[model samples]
Target: MKKTSDLEEQLKEITQQRNLLLKALDVLEEGIHVVDSSGRTIIYTKGCEKIEQSKSDYILGKHISEAYELDDETSVQLRVLKSGIAVKNHHTSYITSQGKRADIITNTYPIFENGKIIAAVSVNRDITKLGELTEKIIELQKNLYSGEQKRRKHANGTIFEFDDIIGESDSIKQTIKIAKKFARSLSPVIIQGETGTGKELFAQSIHNYSSRANGPFVAVNCAAIPESLLEGILFGTSKGAFTGAEDKSGLFEEATEGTLFLDEINSMSMLLQTKMLRVLQNKTVRRVGGNKEIPVNPRIISATNVDPMESIAKNQLRNDLYYRLAVATLVIPPLRNRLDDIPILARYFIEKNSKIMGKNIKYISDEVFEIFNKYNWPGNVRELEHVIEHAINMADSTDTKLSVQHLPPHLREKFTHKHHFYKDYKVNNLQQTLLDIEKDIITQELINNDYNITKTAKSLGISRQHLQYRLKKLNIKKQK
Candidate 1:
């Protein structure tokens, strides 16, 4: 009798402990509630006031269904409490004060007493904003295969294959062949290029071609994230690793058995660079404040607009890390070096963005070609995309032709240069130097005239015969 009495006392103490824990949980800033035996929400925490976007005094005694409505699928979670079972991370929708709906994920567990459920405890997390931000990833993916189109990616979206690579140039084709071969190996690869040269596209294409195509293609912008938060974000933290932290997975870990593309990697701090180097060497990562080492087999791909060597010289990136990264590097040529591809790339972007922006774009005019040919595209592919998109918008919506006159003022500057007169005509020491000067002058004249010889000569304040003589003598081919 005495032992059984002592045992009952111990049970009472345990019950008290549970009650105290429940009270502590209710006081948390996170949304938490308790449904007691009578199906009354007996414990209403002010934590939920913010998530429901409601005032603290308004929610205390409301029914579970009365306080929040559910979408079609998550409404079934109500049965879990009724059946005395536990459910977690069940995604549901909530009607906010503005009468707009948002997504909230909940974790619910039934509290048992003497082998019977006495109550249900729930924690709700709002994730609607996060869900929308997640769609930007699809935007990045679409940017890869889209050429000039603006669209977001979805699960059902078509992934890029080798055929999606649009270039007949030998260098581009050879680069693709090497990329495809390396993609099959699933090793770390670095793509080096100037800004807007399609580094992410190549990364995505390589991922799609790899064995890990079915897994997530996680891309993180090292430059975009702040250094303070970057470390925690790259290597996730344990629950309450610091104040207000829930369990979060870092990009490298989240991309387990997949590919993790760290863009503008030179932006990572020196401290984080050391941590990253270890992960690269060990194929493992330790969470912040976590002692356990996790083996990650994700393929690594990094890209940068700035030259990696230059970055290393500035101490932005470690020289040792640079050597590890450049085992197989691919350098993308600027658009000026690949002028033959300009028309093809331009028309592709015009047609695609036109369809998306609902503008009618039919053809590129000879004037547009002259504009394309004369100017060096310093902004590369991305600049071309935006310029064409702007042209589509500025032209008559029904008009299908794009000409030089339609281009913006800034774009016109590329083809414009002030003729510098040498006071002495004998400045050239070599025939090549004179030829070069005359070639530049003739080219400028052609651009000023829209490549029309009569108009060009008139612009140069000279006769067409004189312009033709100089162009021929200098062996300068006038743009057609």
Candidate 2:
């Protein structure tokens, strides 16, 4: 019994020393975790806190059966726990906060000490910078491997130089010149215009022109994606925030060191407007379930169709956020206002689509110009393009001579068709012009009616003698 007791004491001492070494190693080693079979977390380190964005004290002494989630419902812990195996080296993504975003490299291991499962340890390494470096290498390789057949987009997704754009209009030329200058600066710019006015085009021009054009040019349509999805798309979430998280890289993250073009920013819900305001303010963002703040360095270029001030008054936007975004505002002239450029823009599209559709056609009639200049276009350039395309498809001749008949009915009715003169003549200035031109018309009508005063009065919607006297003052003869 005495010998047995001595052996037991010696074994206890060895176990104590080993455990001491382990605790010390846990402190010294960079990444650490303590997870149990339930896929619930038991404890994590300061390094793990830096990685997983979780503090040990906050999660201590609880039933660590729930696995960490990337979105809402998806869980790494649940998967690891149920399978009774370790999940190793899975990649996860981040929401771009400031320029300093991060990606997580994850490894999950089943915990065992003396032949029994106790906990799991997960190690995560941030790969934000690695991603950027890889992109650089890819770009370099492309430049090297295909030196003969060179085709590349500028960081802002545009080709450099006047030769890049195929328009000769003074407006487009001037706009491009100004845009190249705008790209050099880092300040926020507001692209204001009607929908389909090429606000995106200008935004891309500015981005490609800027010094930071080497970065990503991520275009996000605020109106296209719903608010719920946008939060995760913008800020990003961990392995599990709510569920089913495969880990996503938000647009903000994708645009690191580049420009983020928020198209139709006016359509963003007011709640997201407030959240966006916070991003602009801090230049750092916390993921949906993450505790650590990540930095981001991308430029923000926001576009809106509505007047910024009007949007604020309507309570659809936060005034503070508008001010930040509108630090530099560029109002893209509407297609109607820039009517001088329509011919060039039209030919460009026609040439492009014609090449694609295997059609060789050219020319626009002067009457087509008359219709174009006269029509009050509600849909702007996009509408015009559609109209031209329709006209082209319907044309019997190879030449692109679009006439009044070729115009869509809604557009054609406002001009000089005989059936529409009366209703089409409704205008204030023309009303005054008609008053002067009417007496001669009145006498002509009266003569046609054989000067029957009652019939003339009835037709003119006035007394017969009143019409005759007016004809005399204007010297419109009472024809025999």
TM-score of each: 0.58, 0.56
**After best superposition, candidate 1 residue 211: deviation in angstroms?**
1.8
1-480 per-residue lDDT for model 1 (tens digits): 999999999999999998898678767877876776545567666666666667645555655566555322334335655677677655545565445665556788888899877777788776657645554653564355554332534242335566666667777778788888888887688898888878887888888888888887887888765555567678877763432345667777878878888899898989889999998899888887577788887888899888888998899999888777777787877777777788888889888888887888888777677777777777888888888888887766756777554677786565544654322455547777777776777776575444667767876789989988987777777556
Score residue 371 of candidate 2 by CA lDDT: 72
TM-score, cand. 2 vs. native: 0.56
Q: What lDDT score belongs to each candidate, Candidate 1 first? A: 0.73, 0.66
lDDT of 2 by residue, 1-480 (tens): 999999999999999997786577457434565666555455555665565455566655544432232322234555565565887656555432122233656687776778777666767665545655544643453243232224555534444343555456576677677666677799999888887777876886787777876777777776755454567677877666633344556667778898888888878888778878887898887777676778887899999988888888998878888899988888776677777877887787677656555556576656577678877666777787888777667555444444445557676556635323233345569766676557546654454334556656775788867876776767776454
Kindly give the number of clashing pairs for every candidate. 1, 33
Model 2 scores what on Cα lDDT?
A: 0.66
Off by over 4 Å in 1: 1-159, 416-480
Question: What's the true lDDT of residue 290 in model 1?
Answer: 77
In the order shown, the candidates' Cα RMSDs to the true structure are 15.1, 18.7
